[model samples]
Target: MAFLELHGLTKTFGGVPAVDELNISVETGEFLSLLGPSGCGKTTTLNMIAGFLDPSAGNIRLNNAPLHTVKPRDRGLGVVFQSYALFPHMTVSENISFGLEILKVPQGEARRRVEDVIDLVRLAGMAHRFPAQLSGGQQQRVALARALVIEPPLLLLDEPLSNLDAKLRDDMQSELRRIQRSVGTTTIMVTHDQSEAMALSDRIAVMNQGRLEQAGSPQEVYDKPASAFVSGFLGKTNLLHGRLQRGGDGIGVIDIAAHRFRASDDQTCSPGPVKLSLRPEHIRIGKDAEDHACRVSGQIHSRVFLGDRWIYDVNCVLGTLLVYGQSGAAPFEDAETVSMSWDAAKLRIVEAGHA
Candidate 1:
């Protein structure tokens, strides 16, 4: 049985659905991320799961026990908010011990748990300080320690690392994953940061416009998206809109202008316009296709140096295409004509409309 199950879960405001019929099942000790942009209902779903908001329809079950009627505090869940929400007057040790005290756990056990989490998050020396005196990263650790000291069955993190700087956020991502693994807790996080989700989640559920677009391992969702919104949202992707063509043995092709790109035979493509999605990194510049590769030519219109990689904007037979490649080699000047190629297996064909 699934450890956490959300079946037909939904929420609405002003008669409009913020979270439509959504069904998902998470196994024990699994780390899952609900990833999407602002107003996409990822936060709303998290809120409902945390018992902050009541669902308009459907149920949330944990270990076969329905949670829809449970109060947030009574649900036995730990939550870390984006803001950290540490009490200004409380020191790190105090903040971490508050939950235990509220539950009337023995003072000795609470102290032991607090010390363990403080070490786990690498806040050994900072526990004596208050939130106002700690760094952003340190405060984040305090929030995490507070959540974990209770040893809840499930932990929900709502953009808990979003407030930190880029480098600090990166460090915290590693720290967060380490602590979760050590404790072997089932964690569900809501995040708009794709890199964070990909780095930390065992699986990712991509949501858009109040509905689940796709759910799979990070690489699975990135390599093969279920819709245009997912392809465009999770990372950088160039979508080429085109006409559909079916060939022998159920083979499918998407034709853009005079160029035709191969589509997987397994995809159920409708008899109409289609969109072919390709990641920028998959495209090679100044290269011809190998025997099994797909080749095309384009004129470079612009290029940007990003230290680690170069991004080139090119005009091709299909449309404007973006290519990402490693930097430090000879740069392609504007207006330079270059050949681009990718493995025929790299392209993904999706239904025309965005998800």
Candidate 2:
């Protein structure tokens, strides 16, 4: 059974529908991310799940129990917002103990819970410090501890690490994953950062304009994107437009600027226009390029050094295709002739619409 479920969920603000008929099932102990761009309704969906915003339609269930009528505080949800939402006047211990105090739990019990969570979040030595005194990453950890100390059934993180610097954000991602695994809390995070979602989630629901575009494991979502939007949004992609043709060898072929390239057959296609999705890293550049696979020759228009890899823009028969080569490999210079090819198996057949 799913740990959390949303059936036909809808939310509207004035005339704009922020979330529409969004149906999703999150497995118990799974870390799921609502991944999308700004205005894509990821946060709106999180809000609905947290009971902060009532849905315009449909029901939310936890382990098959209805949650639509539950108050936000009584819904057994722990939320960590992007802003941290720590109380400025309270010390770290007080902030972490606030929820227990609101429930009128005994002071000793609240202190014990606070101490346990502070240790769990690795903030044992900083209990007496105020939020103003803690670093951004530390403050985030405190906010996380504050939520977890209550031992809620679900945890909702709304871009929780967005406030941190780049290096700190990277550290916090790994830290968050470790803490989540240790506690095994059913988690749902909302974030626009594709890398963050890919790194942390067991599965991701890609959303756009109020609808769910696709939901799958990170590799499944990245390697076999269901739509053009997912292909471009999750990571770098080379989208080549072409028409399908059946080769005499019982294989499928795509015609790109008069060049016929072999590709794996998709039986559903009926010899029509289709788009091919290729990841930048999938395209290989070699001196002795073989023509047995899908091959195209192009001139290196530009080369960019991106830390551990080199991104090359090649002007080929299929238009400008971006190829990512490892940093220390044979460097291809600008305006140099190059052969770009990838295993036909790597190409993904996609329809035209972002649908």
Candidate 3:
């Protein structure tokens, strides 16, 4: 059995579903991220799992036992909210040891655990300081340490790093991953940031409009998105309307405007009107047409330099397509004609509309 399981888990408010029939299985010691935009039910799913909200219909199981029946405080799950939620009057040590105090752990053992977690989060010297005295990063560490001090079976983080600045958030992402790895804890984090989810999760379950759109590794979801919502949400991509014609050799040809592009026949779609998702980075600009399986001629409509890469909007025979060029490579100027090419395997047929 999976370490944690949610079968048809659901929630509703005012007769409208906030989370609908969501199912997920999490292995022991694995990190799974619930990722989506705001109001996409990611937070609601996390809340249901954390026992902060009751499920309208469904079962939550932990260790093959029913977990939904348990009260919030008795679930023994560590949760760090978006807000640190530390008691302003309590010192770091006091905050971390509070759970142990409630559990009636021996004073010596509680003190030792508190000290160990404090060191684990690298806040050894700041144990005596209150939340008001700590910086945003330090306070975040305190919240994380407090949650870890209990050593619960599951750790839940709801946008835990959202409050930190960009640099701090990056630093804390590394720190959080390291801490989770060292402890080998089963963790579920909820976040709206795609980059954050990609950087931190072993698997990502993307939600849209109270339903699960797709669940897979970062690369799997990015390369082969299940729907138009996922293809557009996970990263920058050009979604072009086309007509598909399946070939006999497990390959398909997509006709976009006046151009015909070859794509893999992996997706289950009729040979009719379809949507093709092509990542900007996959479309090579200024490449030799003789070296590629598919090629198109286009003129650069506009270009934007974003430090490490250049984004170009090219007006091709098909339409305006976005392409990415590495900063180290020569960039094309506006109105410059170039040959754009991509592998047939990189083009994907995605279902239209959101889930």
Candidate 4:
């Protein structure tokens, strides 16, 4: 059995569902991320799993036991909120030891656990400092340490790094993953940040409109999105309308405007109107086009250098398509005619519309 499972988990307010029939499973010691936009029910689902919200219909199971029946405080789960929620007057050691104290743990054991967690989170010397003395990243680590000190079966984080600046957030992502791995804790974090989810999760469950859009490993979800909403949500992609035409040799042709693009035939859909998802990095430009199966001519309408890469908007007979090129190489200038090509295997057939 899965370590944590949500079967038909649902929640409603005023007769409207905030989370509807959501089903997902997390393995023991695995890191799963609930990812979606604001009000998409990712947070709502996390709240339900953490026992803060009751499911209107459906059930939650942990280790084959009913979790919905348990009260929030009695559930034995650790939660770290986005705000950190550290008390101002308490020292770092006190804040981390609070949970153990509540559980009536002996003073000696609590002190030992607090000290170990402080070292684990790299706050050894800062144990005497209050929340006001810590930086954003340090405060985040303290929140995490407090949650870990209790040694709960499950750890829940609600956008825990959202408040940090870009560099600090990036640094903490590595730290969080390291800490979780070192302790081998099963964790579930809710975040709207796509890169964060991809960076930190063993699996990502994307929610939309109170329903699960898709759930898979980061590479699987990115390279083979289940829907247009997922493709657009996960990263930059050129979404175009096309008509699928099945060919005899197990290949299919997509008709986009006057251009013909070949794609591998999965035979999941009949020849009909379809939506194509092609990532910008997948589309090769200039001499890089020589090896690809599908080729087209376009003019670079605009280009923006983003340190690590250059994003180009290329206008072709079909439409405007986005392309990404590495910054180390020379980039095509604006209005320059260029050849764009991509392998047939790189094209993805996604569900129509943004749902």
Candidate 5:
């Protein structure tokens, strides 16, 4: 059995479900993320696991022990919040030792564990500083250290770095991964940020309106999204609502307005009206593409530079499409007609939802 298991985990408010029949598993020492937009039940799921909220219907098991009846303090779980939630008057060491103090651990043992986690979180020199004296990232580390000092079997973080600036958040993402790897504690985090989830999680469970849409590795979810919502949510994709039909040479052709684009026979759905998802990064403009690639024409409606890459909004018969290319590459001028190409394997069959 998985180290952490949520079976039929659900919650309701005013007779309406906030989390509905959600199921996921986290392996021993693995890092799992619940990722989705606001009010999508990610936080609620975390709260249920943390013992703050009761499930309307479902069971949460930690190492095969029922968690619903266990009090939050007795569950042997560590939690960090977006707010940091540090005691302003307490020094970093004191803050981390508070949990141990509550559990009546020996004073010497508490001090030893406090020093260990402080070093683990790279807050060695800031042990005596109060929360108010530390930077945002440092304060976050204190919160994490406090959670870890107890040596909990499971760690839960809820948007823990959301309060930091963009650069610090990025830096802390790396640090957080390092901390988790060093401890080898099973962890589950809840975040709405896609890149953060992709960077830190061993597996990501994408939620929508209280349901699990897809759960897989970062590469698997991004490259092989199972539904229309998953395709659109994970990253930038030029979703095309079109029809499909059997075509020549064992390939399936997708009919989009005046075009018939080739698709992988292995991914073709029922032969009729279907939707196609083409990532912006996959579409190439001009002749700078491999030979025999599917070539299509589009008018550059708009373009923007984003340091590392250029996003071009192209208008074609199918619809408006976005293409991502390297910043060093020459860009097509606005309203200029350009040729675009992508390999047939890049075309994906997705849900036939609204365009």
Candidate 6:
């Protein structure tokens, strides 16, 4: 059995379901991310795991023991919030030691543990500083240290880096990963930022509305999205609607307005209906076609220069498609006809849905 498990978990408010029939397992010492947009149930699921909100249905288990009946303090879980919920008057050391003190741990032991966490979070030198005296990142570190000082069996972080500036957030992402690995605590983090989840998680559980859309390694989820929504949500995608034609080689082909493209045969679609997803970077555009497969000729409708790359809106007979290429590669004038191509293997076949 996994260290943390949630079975058929759900939460409802005023006749509406915020989280529905969600099930997931987290291995001990693994870092998992609950990732989705706002109101997508990521925070609700975290709250349920932390014992703050009782589930409308199902069970939460920690270390194979039922946790729903236990009080939040007795659940052996630590949570860090987006708003650095620190005691303004207390020093960093006192803040981290508060949980231990409330639990009646020996004074010496509490001090020792506080020192350990302060060092772990790299706040050793700021131990005597109040929350207001620290930077945003430092204050957030104090919050994390406070959570981990209790030596909880599981750690939950709710967008702990959201308040920091972009550069500090990036730095803290790496720091948090290091801290988790060193401590080997089972962790679940809730975040709406896809890049942050990709950077920190061993696996990510992507939620939508109230259901888990997909769960897998970052590469698995990004390179092989299970549905159109998953593809469009994780990153930019060029969606094309078409009919399916099974080739003799077991690959499936999609018939766009004026082009036929091949995708892997992993899709469960009827021969008459299908949808294909392509990433903008996956599409290559140039005139020098020495040797390549799946090429298409189109007219360049618009081009914009973005740092490190150029974004071209192409008007192909199939429809308008976006293509991204490295800067200074080739220049195509507006209304000028051009050829675009992409690797057949890069095309992802999904069940037919709205374009």
Candidate 2: Cα lDDT at 344: 79
TM-score of each: 0.95, 0.96, 0.96, 0.97, 0.96, 0.94
Question: By summed lDDT, which 10 consecutive residues of candidate 4 come out lowest?
Answer: 346-355
Off by over 4 Å in 4: 265-267, 287-291, 352-355
Q: Per-residue CA lDDT of candidate 1, range 240-332, in tens?
A: 777777867567776778777676656675757777788999988874434543778889989999999999998988789999967977888
lDDT (10s digit) by residue, model 5, range 168-205: 99999999999999999889999989999999999999
Q: Tell me how candidate 5 scores on lDDT.
A: 0.88
TM-score of 2: 0.96
Q: Where is the poorest 10-residue window by lDDT in model 6?
A: 346-355
Error at 211, model 5, angstroms: 0.4
How good is model 3 by TM-score? 0.96
- On residues 241-273, what C-alpha lDDT tens digit does candidate 4 reach at each position? 888886687677887887778866563677788
In model 1, which regions exceed 4 Å deviation?
A: 248-250, 287-293, 352-355
TM-score of 1: 0.95
Model 6's alpha-carbon lDDT is: 0.88
CA lDDT of every candidate: 0.89, 0.89, 0.91, 0.91, 0.88, 0.88
Q: Is candidate 2 or candidate 4 better by lDDT?
A: 4
Query: Which stretch of 10 consecutive residues in model 1 shows the poorest summed lDDT?
Result: 286-295
Give lDDT tens digits, candidate 2, residues 122-189. Answer: 99899999999999999999999999988888999999999899999999999999999999999999
lDDT of 3 by residue, 56-169 (tens): 999999999999999999999999999989999999999999999999999999999999999999997898898999999999999999899999999999999999999999
Quick one: how many clashes does candidate 5 have? 0
* Candidate 3: Cα lDDT at 125: 88
